[model samples]
Target: MRKGRGRRAVLAVLFTAGAVLLLGPGAGAGAGGPGSVRQDGERPSFRLRTHEPHTITPDEGDSIPPLTPAFGNTGPVAAPLGVALRVTVTDARFDTIALDTIPRNCYLAKYHRTLICEFSDAVPAGAAYELAEPLPKVSGDYYAVNGSYTYSVWPLGDPPAHTEDYTAQYERGKDTAVGLKPVAMSTLKGDGESTGDGEDTGDGEGTGDGEAKGGGEAKGGGELRFVSDGYADRADWGIEGIKLRGRIGEYAEASIPEPTGAAQRVRVEVPEGTSFAPLTRQEREGLPSEIDYCTRDAEDGNIYCSNPRWYVTLRVRIDRRVEGAEGRISVAEPGNGDTNPGNNTAPIKLEVEDGPTSIDRWVPPVSGFPVEHDVPLETAGSDDLASPPEPSVISVDGRTGVILLVAGASAVTLALEAFRRIRRARNRGGRRVTP
Candidate 1:
């Protein structure tokens, strides 16, 4: 009886070991569990997480203490990893501090609302991966308050496996007063419409058709205004010219701030087949002397100008043509203090008027060639056709050459008349003509 009991115990132990091997880590244990092989047989399991600040407050510039996100591999085997970060803000104005500074491996998608990052480095099991450089600073308008921003990180190609705490409340502090606002007009002149106090309504209101009302005070004590006239005319010779203007004003309520090293500028982009040309002395007659213009480069299609007198004008010429071409005009690097950023850009459309193109104007029609004319050539010199004038070589130019050319033409005319007469006579007698 002792031997039989020992054998039964050994058999039960063997059975349990077999069951563990067949059922994986434990009974009822799911795939993706610790040390468990996935049913689909993918090599890596990832734990991605997003770390966001509890509260964000807009400062004079970019906010400090940016969000940091990370991902880690949990499986036993090392494998390539991909990460996707999605930051949905309460307002469209809330965005990363600078888009150009994002990681090289990361790319913006879904209208810049998402970032997909694929790591080139192999992710070793149990190792965490976080951004080496500082992440973007989350920013919002000065008036943005109590708005929430949510962010989530997951495997790049998989979304259902996101972390449990994917969405969190992002608090915005009280409204910050300093900001920049830009206003644009489709034409050079703004309509004579202003509030009774000659100031904008402070609502950032404007027409959607590329023209906007004036943006109130250059908040943050900045006094310069950059404006561009968005009209381009295509000349008959296929070149276009544009004129840009600027306006300067004082902030009576607040003193104008001193110019910083990163001074504001107006940037104009010429249509593709065209480029910016420096204005000639004649063309710069009425422009303000304080406004400095960029030098001309044929290959460069952009123009940059600065300074803002009460009425400053800058003229640029685009000496090439591209049909139906459109360009953009805006203020570059508006800085972090800007309050309103939407009204900064306008469109430049090249106008093509009704008429013939340059091609039609230069080339004459080739139809109805050798027109049948009733007028006949005179053959009065037929007697001199017995021997056609011997060919002559002349190297002289000018009036002497012209006289020789006229004499040679006369001899050729006589020979052609003689041939015509002989042909007519032979045709009447059914014989070949020899001239």
Candidate 2:
């Protein structure tokens, strides 16, 4: 096999995340019921499946179909929590990562050689998260190179599988970690009418018991909004500052309650090519709590969650080979004093794909988010993924980024257009031509 040279494989990772509200109905919710803060509630089992085998040609303009591997909350009613996911590239010339739908929070970093993905929050119980992004990458060449990555997930804080700091994965032994859609629901519907918790148009007033009994509708709701710059074709360039917005509000009839650490634990998720950046001193001051960084030890970088009144915003920047983002985020914490736990957690559906973007938006944000989302990259039938390809290097001139390869030549030549032009003219004129 020809040893194709390209860019260095900077051990990269794709991330997914979800929130686990510690105050499960099974546990006590009042101040002293179950030690809501320390419960750790039981961690749920995670099931990860690969997509079917697919072939493609990678080129500059061709947007290749992104490999979508999905992880499901196959466990029972456990507090929402984050999981650790890993993708092992075993086999092509190069590959890129992107997310159409995103998690509550996700961060991407270069591992030794492979991508180590971790989520900020937890995967919801019995919730199915499929990556909403189509994940299309155009071909840079005509070679039908096969690319693949093996994905695995484990509970974020699981014993022998977790670290105090997420970045600890770099120095310490490999530790695993931990969406989307854009689902905007104003309120629940019963028999096609807004029968939330309150409201009566003179015809008949809505009662909590009636609405809850007649239709299994939720009392309160929220929205998930994500903005991403389209994926990049080149390896040198990257996408930056993808915006993640999560707003927790009530459906008109829903009652408001006092804020608690639960409000501080609201989460935001991101995808593989994206990761959270360090928070600024000012941003940190306005944040609610450090739930995001609560688990991290000294050396491990961490960012805390905020206790916002109704909204939280997170910024994720592009690493490399990132096209779009797709994922979901919602409040999974125990509600302040709600009789019905039905509205405790709500899932939104969202997905974003490749599109034209402004030059200014090309760079994503420098901030990072915790893992937690509804985005799941999926493949139907049996999960059959192509083995990940090997890494390569690409050399470009500052001006032209042009490289010339001579057949059977040992030396690889890299030169700019100016150098080539001067050389060409010199060869033709042989000192006869004057500048």
Models 1 onward score TM values of 0.25, 0.25
lDDT of 2 by residue, 249-335 (tens): 100011112232223233334445445544467856776662222111133344323322433344444332333444333333321
* Root-mean-square deviation per candidate: 31.9, 29.7
Candidate closest to the true structure, highest lDDT: 1
User: Model 1, which residues run further than 4 Å from truth?
Assistant: 1-39, 49-52, 57-65, 81-99, 147-435
lDDT of 1 by residue, 285-368 (tens): 755666445433333445654444313233332222346666665553232333334445555554433322232122211222
Sequence-dependent TM-score of model 2: 0.25
In order, what lDDT does every prediction score? Answer: 0.36, 0.32
Worst 10 residues of 1 by lDDT: 246-255
